[model samples]
Target chain A: EAGVAQSPRYKIIEKRQSVAFWCNPISGHATLYWYQQILGQGPKLLIQFQNNGVVDDSQLPKDRFSAERLKGVDSTLKIQPAKLEDSAVYLCASGAGAHQETQYFGPGTRLLVL
Target chain B: SQQGEEDPQALSIQEGENATMNCSYKTSINNLQWYRQNSGRGLVHLILIRSNEREKHSGRLRVTLDTSKKSSSLLITASRAADTASYFCATGARGAGNMLTFGGGTRLMVKP
Candidate 1:
């Protein structure tokens, strides 16, 4: 059983630049999520999708952060005009259903904005 | 706003010792989960306890939930050096649809 996959494990970019992170969830998983984890803090959800449709994105920064889980298998989180505050690890996770069950996570992308 | 907060931001103990961490939440929850994250890695689910449940044990890990106080505890007995990592507690509420509110995390260091 393959776990969730994400890339570029590490990214370094300048402030105001655009950065994009990709995620490929586990096979047959139905739900996907994107979370931002600042240093020394827990992950904060940015967006959630259930099969190509957004389930929740209330915490997402609409001004510069956007995410899409097209085809219900892969997802991409984009942070445009990135600020230094955006320098955090972006994690992607997947679950079997829309319940509080086990969730598999990817390696995560560590973004460092200068 | 974060729903839970873990005590003892960091802890260190020799191998074969017990490691106990606490998590306190703010509101009612449908379930609570614990995850471990190694240095520079993603989180791995360790255990999950439902609202109706009080205690669950998985191998060397034991979890207890007290809804009355809205708090939970994770006990790792005879922990090994491999157990050195950051552990986080996450809470799930009704109608959340799988959303998890996590705590700041407790860093555990087990010396061999």
Candidate 2:
């Protein structure tokens, strides 16, 4: 089986510019998540989706960040008017929606905002 | 806020030695998982230990969880240069939307 897949492994953008990242999760996985990992820090959950429905997005910056999992297979995360603080690795993961199931992660999209 | 915190932000050891990393959490959790990332790539799941379980072993990796103390330890036996990577501990709680809260990772460098 194929693992989760992401596009544009690395991205460089200027502050105030917009950027978007895409993620295609593993087949049959119902839970998809987006996380941000700043340098020297652990990944912080930005949003989570379960079969096209958002499970949680309390940490997402509503003013600047938004994500959607339309059709529930692939998802996209976008940041408009990006800021320097938004420079971080964006990771996407998927799981089987079980309490004990392990999540599979994709090669993250590293964004560098200047 | 991050739920878990790993100790010893960085560790360096020679090959063939055992490497131990510790993680402590603030709230109750259903399970704790350990992952390894190589050169900023995607993270690979190493091990997972449930709250009801005390210890688990997978090949050279051993994980011990102490719910009473809300701490966990990971031991890599006879470490190799290939084991050099950043290790992170993630906690899954019952009320935390089933999302894993990761701790700041510990960077381990195994010298040959």
Candidate 3:
């Protein structure tokens, strides 16, 4: 089976600018996740989707960050007025279920904000 | 708050030797998983050990889980130069709303 797919392997933008990252999860997977991995740190969950409905997004910066999963197949995460601290790898993962399932990850989108 | 924290932020070893990385976590977990990342790229799943299972093996990788201690360890036997990468342990906790919390990771360098 094909793994999760992401676009724009890398991107660079200036601070206060806007950028968007896209994710296409594995087929038949019911759970999708977006994680931010900062340098020297592990990935942190930004949002989670279960069939186009958000399950968790408590960590998301609602003021500037917004995410949506349309049709529960393709998802997009956007950050308005990006910050230097936002420079990190955005990882997309999919799993068969929210629990007791292994997750498959994509190559990720490496974003750098100057 | 990160639920998992790995010890020995980094490790350097020679090929053909065994490499061990430890992870400690707070609260109960349904399982623990090990993942490897190369060059800051996406992580690749290595192994998973359930709360009830004390140990699990996949190829040259072995994972041991001690629920009593709230800790786990990953052992890579006969490590290779290609094995040089960052290894992380994530805990799946139902208490944390069924999310997997990852550790800071252990950077391993294997010299051939």
Candidate 4:
């Protein structure tokens, strides 16, 4: 089966500019997630969606970041007025509904804000 | 605030040896998962152990959980140079949404 897919494997932007990342989850997956991974650090959950509905986004930066999964199959994450600190890799993952279901991840989009 | 924290930021060992990594969390969880990442690629799920379970094995990988202490450990036996990568532990808490909170991860390097 095909795994999660993401676009623009690498991105370069200037501070204060806006950038967007896209994700296409595995077929029949019910849950999708977006995470940020800074250099030398683990992924940090930015938001989660269960069938186009947000499940959790408490850690997301409301002032600058937003995400949406309109059809429950594909999702997009946007970072506006990007800051230097926003330089990191954004990863997307999908999983079935089971609580212990294993998640499949995409190659991720590496963003470098200058 | 990060829910999990991995010990030993980095580890280096020779091929054929065993490599172990530990993780600790602050909250109660229903299950814990381990994932591996090579270079800049996305994470690959390795294994998962429920709270009621103490140990699980998959091929050369072994995971042990201690709910009482809110900790888990991953052991990779007979490691190979190809096993060099970063390993992260994620926790799924009950009623805390299905999202997972990951730890800083442990970078393991197996030299031939």
Worst 10 residues of 1 chain B by lDDT: B92-101
lDDT per residue (tens digit) for residues A20-81 in model 1: 99999999888888999999999988888888999899999999999998688899999999
| Tens-place lDDT digits, model 2, residues A5-74 | 9988999999999999999999988889999999999999999998899989999999999999999999
DockQ-based class of model 2: medium
Per-residue CA lDDT of model 4 for A1-114, tens digit only, reads 898999989999999999999999999888899999999998999998988899889899999999999988999999999999999999999986556257789999999999
Measured against the true two-chain complex, the DockQ scores of the candidates, in the order shown, are 0.70, 0.69, 0.57, 0.66
lDDT of each: 0.92, 0.93, 0.89, 0.92
| lDDT for each residue of candidate 3 in B84-104, tens digit (9 for 90 to 100) | 999999988664235678999
Candidate 2 vs candidate 3, TM-score winner: 2
Off by over 4 Å in 3: A97-100, B95-97
Question: Which docking band does candidate 1 fall into?
Answer: medium
Error of 4 at B1 (Å): 1.9
lDDT tens digits by residue: candidate 2, B72-112: 99999999999999999999866524789999989999999
Instruction: Rank candidates by DockQ, best first.
Output: 1, 2, 4, 3
lDDT of 1 by residue, B8-111 (tens): 79999999999999999998888999999999999999999999999999999999999999999999999999999999999986774578888999999999
Best candidate (score: lDDT)? 2
lDDT of 3 by residue, A8-113 (tens): 8999999999999999988878788899999999999899888889989989999999999989898999999899999999999987544635778899999999
